[model samples]
Target: MSNIVKAKIIEKIQGFYEAVDDNNNKFTVKLRGTLKKTNDKLNCVIGDIVQIDVEDNVIIGIEKRNNLLLRPLISNVDYVAFVCSIKDPDFDIINLYKNLLWVDRENINTILILNKIDLVDDKELEDILKLLSQKLKHIKVIAISIKKNIGIDKLKEYIENKNIVLSGVSGVGKSILVNKLLDIEELEVGEISKKTKKGKNTTINTRYLEKNKIKIYDTPGYSAVAIPDYTDKKEIMTWFPEFKNYLSLCKFRDCLHIKEPSCIIKFKVSEGEIDKDRYEFYKTLVENKGI
Candidate 1:
């Protein structure tokens, strides 16, 4: 009889992959050639649930995935923690919208983190909360200062027992915060360059770490974000939760909300009902994609 065990792919280092079973046993595994017969795509990524045919403590097969992320190569993400800084690679609302759009396109839930709040004044932090509240109605934004150890407990409580993907622009102190959350000191923290005002790519690959029943996959900070393609430009509007109320009120059956006569979305923006910035962002996305 063969030793067949099931586990979740935690991380890959060098050539061997690490997996954690239900019993908390860690196994270092390698792929089996028989995997090629069933699935042509044998590549495995972090956060994948796999079955291992262990003979002498090695991986012999990889099971199919529930879902997969192309760039970072992560799968089965329950939540995405979008970590944004208040300063030092300053917070850009447009970029936040871009990140939200991509996350929504993937049909994944998000938790926006306003990190480094210790660097900002109360008023500045309050303003950020207000702005995020207005534009991101569906998403929840948590303000945290890993340096001061503020709001860490709240964030931890929210992520309890969930698989989270920590993502953001460089220089936002994501790794540092994650290390603090896990009570580990080894994860490298990237510094913001004085000349470029950008963060170094310290995290080269996806890393999986678990703490207090919560699992997190920290991905490399993305400088340039690409929104997912849509077959119909009108479909993009549905991703914005705030637009749903007015979508049915539009005069045309298929309204992209741009240059369409009696467009309820445009009217809402004009009347200060909808966020102008988000509306503008959507318009620009539609125009740039030419969908």
Candidate 2:
């Protein structure tokens, strides 16, 4: 007799997937031939719920995903915590904005985690927080020092009972954060390169881990994140939550907000209602197609 069971794909190693069923039984399963052929719309990725034949150790079917991230290629994520460093690798505001836009396009919740707060002075941290507050008023921002144990408990509270993906540039202490959160040193922590002053890549692949009722996907750190292209350029503005109010007030119904006469978004930028840097970034994306 063959046993069919529901499971969640936790990780993919080699050609087999590590799936866990409701009873927390682990199985290394391969995709069924027919299921792989019909995987056009359904991708077998981490966080995917599937049906498996335990006896055959094959993934028989995949359920529809609630949401999918193309760049990281993950599915059904409740939140994306973008981790950044204040000192060693330095904070890249442009990259952070790019990440925010990417997740916003997917309609997923986001939280900005500024790690290594201990390295920066009070004034510098305040300034960065102020700037973030002005531009990302809709998003939640958390300043934490894993070394000093500051804001760790608060971070845990926010992500309690949720599935989150920790994403950011390399060397921002993502692996360290995971170890701290899970109270385990299973993940290796890499040191910053002396020559480039950047973090070395410690996590080469994405993995799913669960502890204390929290599920997290630790992804490989990235130095630079590229925003995916969209078919409709007009849709770009919708991702910026700050542009919501003035969008309707624009002169034309289909205003791209660039080189357009009587554009309220432009007028707001001039009036300081919108951050000039952010507006400029949007214009660059719209004109250059995210090149």
| Top lDDT prediction, candidate number | 2
Per-residue alpha-carbon lDDT of candidate 2 for residues 1-291, written as tens digits (9 for 90 to 100): 548888889888766899987677898999888777453534588889999987888888899999987767788889998998888888888888888887887888888899999998999999999998888777789999998999999999999889899887767877678888887854433232442244343666888888887678988866767776779999889888888878899879999999989999999899988989999899889888453
For candidate 2, the per-residue lDDT at 190 reads 28
Roughly what TM-score does model 2 have, to 2 decimal places?
0.86
Task: Compute the lDDT of residue 159 as modeled in candidate 1.
Answer: 91
Clashing pairs in 1: 30-59
TM-score of 1: 0.81
Task: Give the candidate number with the greatest TM-score.
Answer: 2
Worst 10 residues of 1 by lDDT: 187-196
Model 2 lDDT at residue 8: 86
RMSD of each: 4.2, 3.4
lDDT accuracy of residue 55 in candidate 2:
80
Regions of model 2 farther than 4 Å from truth:
37-42, 186-201, 245-249, 289-291
